[model samples]
Target: MKKKICVIFGGESTEYEISLRSAASIINELDKEKYDIMTVGITRGGKWKEYTGKVENIICDRWYDDSLKDVSVDLGGADGALIVYGNGKLEKVKIDCAFLGLHGANGEDGTVQGMLKLAHIPYTGPDMLTSCLGMDKAYTKIMLESAGIDQAKWVTVNDYDRDEIMKKVVDAEEIFGYPMFVKPANAGSSIGIGKAKNRDELMSAIDNAFKFDRRIIIEEFLSGREVECAVMGKRGVVRVSCVGEIKAANEFYDYEAKYSDKVESKLIIPAEFKDGIEKRIKETAKKAFIALDGKGYSRVDFFVNEDDGTVKLNEINTLPGFTSISMFPKLFMHEGFSYAEILDRLIEIGME
Candidate 1:
């Protein structure tokens, strides 16, 4: 019998559109012979809808037009089953496992994971605690520092008081000097990240970041190559994929460079490196993932200094992007893991 999988996507997040794109890709690629698929979408306003439209429409952003009217949750099984109320009746599908293509805020920050846990259902990606830590930039810093991992110098700013927040921002620049990065502590997909080279820009960046999140992470920007690695499983038996490098067209790897300007930005698979550097990066990736109590899978980013080859931990994305051209999938694909193979492996691990 086919496994009844509930592949949920499009959440109340800044990455909502990205989630839809990813969901379409996965739904299209999943083998019909192996699994029974239930498509669920959460709107930006947080409305849950059962989506049965063509996957292509979801990718094209028109799934809400026609097919969406065909399905709605059956309140009978309120425990989060993929239920559908159609033809004047209620139908509930008992999901064997769930694949969350949701990102940022309510979805990626352990909210959905906790919900699934309460429902006693298996879901893909890291467990609740790991998801929460992975989404928190400040907590991730604490974990890395405790593990003796070298990372960028950072200061977290959460004061609603403009004057106090301004003081903390200046103190950070005084310590690290020059170019700094301001990011929302819990946001993903580079949504609220800004690079500032001067104090004026620094202040503006913080103010802009606060619009998206209550807490913000301010870190001294490092001049280095932007590289990343994809990790799977947990602690002892974790597997690391090949190293990948990103050359952003913008001054920094901001939102535009990540999803908008495709032709300008470039990704180098299996980044060329010196004798021991690649191994060091892979080892560091595994260690950082394990140190944060990371389970299932994540994409660990780093900045390798050019002059001295210093590898500094950037952050861990518990549930990274799975789009066709996404770094996580592309990195593993380069290492000989097909997209379908990766989906199957992740689903199997989630069941465990």
Candidate 2:
């Protein structure tokens, strides 16, 4: 019997469209002989809907032309099967495990993971604690630094006091100097990030960042090559993918550079590095993953300072992009793993 794998995507997040792209890629690569794939779409408003056909078709071909109607799951039902109703009829669908492709808040911030845990269903990617920690930039940094990882100097601010935030910004300027990066501590997709080159820009960036999240993180901008490593599996047997370098066309790698083709950002698989740099980066990436108690898979980013030959930890994406053109799959592909093999490994690891 084929195991029923529910590939969940779309949520109330800035990365909703990105998640759809990832879902398409995964569904296309999943081995049909081994698993029964079910495509589940969650709207931006959090409504659960069951759709027909392959996940790739629904995602890439935009086949969601007609709504499959709304579905309700009776928690009391056996094995938590979803009760689908439409045209005055009903059916129940049982889900064995879910392959989550949702990104950003509500989905990636441990909410969905916690619900799945309570539902007694196994799912892919990190557990609740790791997901929550990885979602919050400020807390993640604290944990990383405490574990002796070299990360950029940062200060966090909440909505408590504007005056206090101003004072902190002044102190940050004094300590970290000019050209700082201000970002929302809990948001992803670089949705609310700004580069502050002066005091005025700093204040504006803070205000802009606060618009998206309650907590804002301001850090010193380190100029270097932006590199990332993809990690998979649990502790004691974790595997790291080849390093990939990101070259953003914009002043900083913002939303435009990430999703839009207008902004030119090149991805270099097996990034060019000096002797021992790649090995050191892989080692540090694993350390950072262990530091946060990460599980399943995560992409650890870094900034390699060419001038001083130093590597600084950037941030970790617990659920990184999985589109065919995305870096995560590209890295593994460059390392001799095909897309289908990557998907199989993720599902295999996820089941564990």
Report lDDT (CA) for all predictions. 0.85, 0.85
Per-candidate TM-score against the hidden true structure: 0.94, 0.94
lDDT of 2 by residue, 22-78 (tens): 888888888899999877788877777776766656565364545576665446655
Residue 310 of candidate 1: its Cα lDDT? Answer: 91
The digit string of per-residue lDDT tens for model 1 on 140-238 reads 899889999999999888856566876796689788977889999999989989988898998899889998888898898887899999998855789
Which ranges of candidate 2 are over 4 A from the true structure?
Answer: 53-66, 72-74, 77-80
Off by over 4 Å in 1: 65-80, 261-263
After the best TM-score superposition of candidate 1, give how far the Cα of residue 255 lies from its true spot, in angstroms.
Answer: 1.1
